[model samples]
Target: MTILAELPTPAPTRAAAPVARPSFAARIRRAAPPYLYLAPALVLLVVWTYRPLAQAVRLSFHTWNLLPTSPITEVGLANYERLLSTPDLGASVWRTVLMVLGILPFSLVIPVVVGLVAARVRGRIYQAMIFAPMLVAPVAAAAVWQWLLDPGAGAVNRVLGVRANWLHDTDLALLTIIVVTGWHIVGFAVLVVSAGLSGINPDYADAAAMDGASRGRITRWITLPLLSPTMAFLVLMTVLLSAQWTFPLIDTLTQGGPSDATTNIYYLLWDYGFHSYDAGLGAAAGVIFFVGFGLIAVGVVALSDRVSHHDD
Candidate 1:
């Protein structure tokens, strides 16, 4: 057996398969078109948005009266330092804070409840009636409210049997802004919240009801958790937009006065850049406003996403 089997054992050798490498040109060809397609928008963003931003930043470091012929003096951080030192700045900031607080209760919270109730209504007629406010232009809406709040002859005064100047007194002036401004902006929140409510699964409600959950219990324990994302989004928006919202009304009705009580950041920036012609300080304030607001908006979004996911 040994002699036959061991006669000759020949070893077989195999060549290694060639490595399959993709060509660099082929890879680049596949990736290049997407960037090429994006180039136009990329160029446009830099030209239109970023270019202005860059100019604003550059101007913020210099003292200019917004006159083209004015000498540009680099005062380092003096403009920012001055804004911080300004006595009225904190009050103006606080007023902005007040607006945020005052607006959110009526704007986001009340409308959410209304939207939920409206959703339970059988027909679109009631829904449309409630939502009609959203269709009105902000300026037009402000005008309508201005007429309604006219202290001498307006509907509110007539109904309440009280004759008081609504927009003249500093205390009442900001209040009027809150009410009037709420009218136009609240509608948007209502619509968004309503849409969010409608998207929630009805099965959750049914399940809660089956377990003998009261309406309040269902809403508190079941519905609200599910509605968290929408509510968060609405609140976030309400916070960010609260400052700039009174612009048209404040401009038209009060002009940031009865004693600067309504002079928010928007009004301040306008006053600085346009009214006072201090473009450098205004530009710095713009940067501050943008940065401050950007952080808040980011925080709102992040915290919302976190809370919503945690609920899930």
Candidate 2:
């Protein structure tokens, strides 16, 4: 045993062989696939989104009529100054805020209630029915609503027994548009909320039930906390896109009037760009909206991160 220990311990064992470093080309070859996989998406994003955004920014500095023959002349901040001083700008922005507020109940609040109740439903037919409105094309839906809300010989007036011009009256037009837009898009919100509901683990609810918690308590506590992320997402989407969602309907039904009562920022931008042929004004408004919305998005995202609760 002494001799075995005294043999210099097998020359103190050679240090482990140093691992051969991969060559630079080998390292690059290993990294290439991920970037290669990402290239198509990156290229398309740059071409479609960023490129147009850059063009819009550049166009905002120049006056143009959107004609090829019309030379673009740089007017610096003239477009912005005109836009800020325009009374319509303030009115349009206020209408946009109203649209967002009106859309919130349909997109977030009611959808959450519907989603929670829908979990008890045992058939796909009811689910399909609930989601059917979202499948209808916006133009087609607008056409149907136009017929239904006609000032004369309309079903809505016939039922209510009043010749109220729902779409043409300045007092009722915006509210009517809001309701129609909500009906058109609420199904999509319900679908998203239902999906979020299905994703929640049942164990928490079951445990709560075993602890003598009522259905209302379970929903208010376990279910809603888990659904907060989806609710936040819906709120964010409604705030950002309510005006856009109403744009097509407004164009089809009201054309932003009975005195521009239904004209949100989106319709105003379209009117400036296409109807009035004021490309620089439209671009300036677009840039302002893009920056403003970008800031709002950042704030909403930060708030959502703080408030949203993940089950895991």
Candidate 3:
């Protein structure tokens, strides 16, 4: 008798189960994980930025020092009206405007040109040397200028063989302030413009060159247009933060002085807030300052977007 092996039977298969489809809300919830991760930052932004803005708006409407003992007077727009009529207020606003204009061209045009030219520089040495001034603190830069413009110990007068007082002269004081501020921020501007230039597709410039376009022609038609967004952002930032960026130098070096020639709205607010112990006045000034700059910045960026067309 021979032993025989039994053949195995095939297992029966079951019907395929339906694929589970996510509902609209469930999909949204799943997609929301990234935003949920951002919740801490969102909360911080609201706390630091919006909370003060909201409080400032309410405080601006009333004449309150925001001190414990001080009473809040409901003088709707009185503080604003008072801010408008103050004599030095006009000067502060005007000086701020002038600084914006002075800084805009210096920060926007000069650095961009320098950065472009530096891109073609032979070595890293030259590039670093040119960008060095921007690494210095604004206060330190101003102090250096103060020494240079000393009219006594400063080498500027000695080199030029002139005894003219730089700080004593009110007419020159504001201009000097601009120069000091510009030197401090020049490196940053150069860095931003250089990054923008580096990001530009060299292919466009190459194509333009192939078409017999001059260096200047390619720069004017191709390079500059693409750089508009970066320029626009810088302009907006300089406009919105004109005082904060430059005022510290003025505060530390000049104290807005010689005769208030360099005094900006920030200086005015600071004087009132700290020196005069009048937080109500300072708060009013702060509100006025914020609103004016905010409006101007909004207008500039809005206008820029209308005129600009960026390539992807």
Candidate with best lDDT: 2
lDDT for each residue of candidate 2 in 1-312, tens digit (9 for 90 to 100): 111112454554755744998788987986798799999999999999999999999999999998999899999999999999999889999999999999898898888888877788775787688678888888999999989888687789899989998888999999999999999888889888988888899999999999999999999989999998888888888988898899999999999998999999999998898887889989999999999998988898789879989876
Stretches of candidate 3 off by over 4 Å are 1-49, 64-70
Model 3, residue pairs in steric clash: none
Candidate 3 lDDT over 229-288, as tens digits, reads 777777877777778888878887778888898898888888877786555567778777
**Clash numbers, per candidate:** 0, 0, 0
The C-alpha RMSD of each candidate to the native structure, in angstroms, is 13.9, 11.6, 14.0
Model 3 misses residue 9 by how many Å?
56
Evaluate all candidate structures by whole-model CA lDDT and list the values in order.
0.80, 0.88, 0.79
Better of 1 and 2 by lDDT: 2
Better of 1 and 2 by TM-score: 2
TM-score of every prediction relative to native: 0.85, 0.86, 0.81
Candidate 1 clashing pairs, residues 3+ apart or interchain: none
